[model samples]
Target: MLRNSPLHPLARFLLNIISPLEGNTLSAVKNTQHFVRIIKEQHVTQQDLLVSFDVTSLFTNVPTNKALDVVKKKLSEDESLEHRTSLSLNAIMEMLNMCINTTYFQLDDEFYQQEFGVAMGPITSTQRYIHGRL
Candidate 1:
């Protein structure tokens, strides 16, 4: 829901710019079809097995505090966020924490609030996946 907000894209863009680059990762599979093309080009035979797995309910499974810690660590290591942007790294980190920590849902005359884990529809989902727990 908040993704469509006017400031969301701008925040996302800024985050993308300031965040430390992963450069290469297994998660790149989500970004392109080249993995298949490469496998085909290499003539991967029936004997050659591929082992790939995805975590189900990742949004609910990842611990938000851990994810935030990873972001905070990476932010501290990368100096650009402080010098180039008006937002403090701690402020940026808190914003991410706020985004993921305040999750909730309603189901069948019941309401539940998430005490941990990222909220649905956040751009930071990829970060949680990449960094894992602190």
Candidate 2:
């Protein structure tokens, strides 16, 4: 799938490394949810804000290479391996890749005329819900 596709190469590499990490994905999702909730609560209570500005094209503004690099470094960190963080990393990476592919194809990008690769991580359904927009 990586050999002939428009998806970023770094995304593919991360997917390869994360394929073996088993449990990290769910934890990552939960962590993100927790983080978001905390932020929302803080905004509501501390800032007295009921509305938050969500900027679209947020991910598009993130350089794909940089995002993949951060993921790769985190996945390969000694602390992560020692604590078995790869599992969640793998699951999240796979989920993100699926989301990106789906979004890309939905945009009718001519370069994205291919099927998504295998799903190797856990929390498959939840991941889809969390990152379906990529």
The number of the candidate with the highest lDDT is 1
Cα RMSD, model 2: 10.9
* TM-score of structure candidate 2: 0.31
User: For residues 15-37, could you state the per-residue lDDT of candidate 2 as single tens digits?
Assistant: 55555553455435345677687
For model 1, residues 1-134, the per-residue Cα lDDT tens digits are 25665446655755664545453344445344877765666767789888878777677667777877866776777756656677777777766665555444444455445555555664354434433232
The global C-alpha lDDT for each of the candidates, from Candidate 1 onward, is 0.59, 0.47
**How much is the lDDT of residue 103 in candidate 1?**
47
Candidate 1 minimal-lDDT segment of 10 residues: 125-134
lDDT of 1 at 111: 46
